[model samples]
Target chain A: MLIWRKTMEMIPGGTLITATPEEGRQLAMTMARKSIGAIQPEAEVRKALPPKYANSPDSLTAAAQVVALEFATIAAANKYWRKNS
Target chain B: MLIWRKTMEMIPGGTLITATPEEGRQLAMTMARKSIGAIQPEAEVRKALPPKYANSPDSLTAAAQVVALEFATIAAANKYWRKNS
Candidate 1:
């Protein structure tokens, strides 16, 4: 029983293990946001630009794609919803 | 007239000048995508993960925010859609 529990907790190639899907989702967004900041450090510029694309569906879709990409990476790292057990 | 046209083409502090809003939008998306790629180079992983978040609003919103942030930076650099006269 002890070994089984331990095995469940340890994902072979997983880089992270969240307690819930919500946590995992948030983590993925945070990672994505941090990555954007890494390349573009100007907060003021980022703040001023959302309104321009707020009504543009194409731009929003493009942005969604990026977010999805980040989430995918996080999902893989967490072994696709496998909890920390 | 010639000097006026030349002056119009040169934006004082602009880093880029697109021919139209469509072009600017495309450029901004490209920059955002490139930045994401720079931070996360695993093409296979990115390709596999978007479908997971396709139905998640929060994730999509977060992604849009990042794209908007990138668009904002690009807009500032391009002087807010200022065309190359």
Candidate 2:
């Protein structure tokens, strides 16, 4: 969470979004249409885990991977937006 | 700095304040006057160190201390703000 926030701050005017994975997919689609894709879905990643497994080490590792993927995807989107917008 | 953002998010509408130590001291004093004391001085902490020493491990360690102290101070102020605000 801390690293995610730091990474978010590096980008300007980044509004953090928290949503379910379904909502995330939807929002990502919407942002894609507008060429604005910098959503940080840490909330969805955590929510998708079972309650009993939420704070387990495996869950934490999985969450890290989710965040990393989001960062890369968002970075690519921003690069595209920069070139086109 | 990342820890600071997560800590700030724990509180609502906390726009991070990045300022010089002198400015920080003044702002802390002003916030103190308003009975708002949750100002993180990591910027000031980093600036106060010599430029050559900025990226050294010691500087990083020092910055971490400043952030920790700020967290403790802000948490206390928030406790007070919660009680009084």
Candidate 3:
């Protein structure tokens, strides 16, 4: 991941990758796959920001599904972590 | 990616990752996320193999959606790659 980060530093909007760990990996891998020697300038990162941070009884439930796929993958790969998600 | 492959070598079913590039990344990142120092020897890789290779006009259409998310993410990040899936 570090190499991916460093490799992306050659591009213009590269620093934007530090937004979040998940976002960073997504940016890094995308760049690496394209073999783009430098970060593509003007790249945009669109996100549906926190949705006003629920602050309701359902907040926890909402957050749980955010990374459902990641959790599922982890659970599937490690028996100790397996559970019905 | 290479580092991921090497790190996974210590895990029992680790070599199973090389089955496919997409599967390998999924395996490596999943392993790295869990910090499972040694590969989970009994880990299983479940997959819904190609459904008898469509061998029909719709075959191409079926494949177009398999990596829809990846292409969407790539397009969302790079204007040059942008396209409606």
Candidate of highest lDDT: 1
Ranking by TM-score: 1, 2, 3
Candidate lDDT values, in order: 0.46, 0.32, 0.29
Q: How well is candidate 3 docked (DockQ)?
A: 0.03
lDDT of 3 by residue, A1-85 (tens): 1011113122234222233345434543443333221111212211232344345445444333323423233222233222422
For model 1, how does the per-residue alpha-carbon lDDT over A1-85 read when each residue is reduced to its tens digit?
A: 0000111211122223466667767755654454444334445645655465567787567555665765554455445665555
The lowest-lDDT stretch of 10 consecutive residues in candidate 2 chain B is B20-29
Which tens-of-lDDT digit does each residue in B1-85 have in candidate 1? 1111112322223545555434544454455455555555566766677443433334445544554555445445555432332
**Reference-based TM-score, model 3:** 0.20
Record all residue pairs in model 2 with backbone atoms less than 3 Å apart, i.e. clashing. none
**Fraction of the reference Cα-Cα interface contacts (below 8 Å) that each candidate reproduces:** 0.00, 0.00, 0.00
Q: Which candidate tops TM-score?
A: 1
Q: Give model 3's docking category.
A: incorrect
Each candidate: chain B TM-score: 0.61, 0.32, 0.26
- TM per prediction: 0.37, 0.22, 0.20
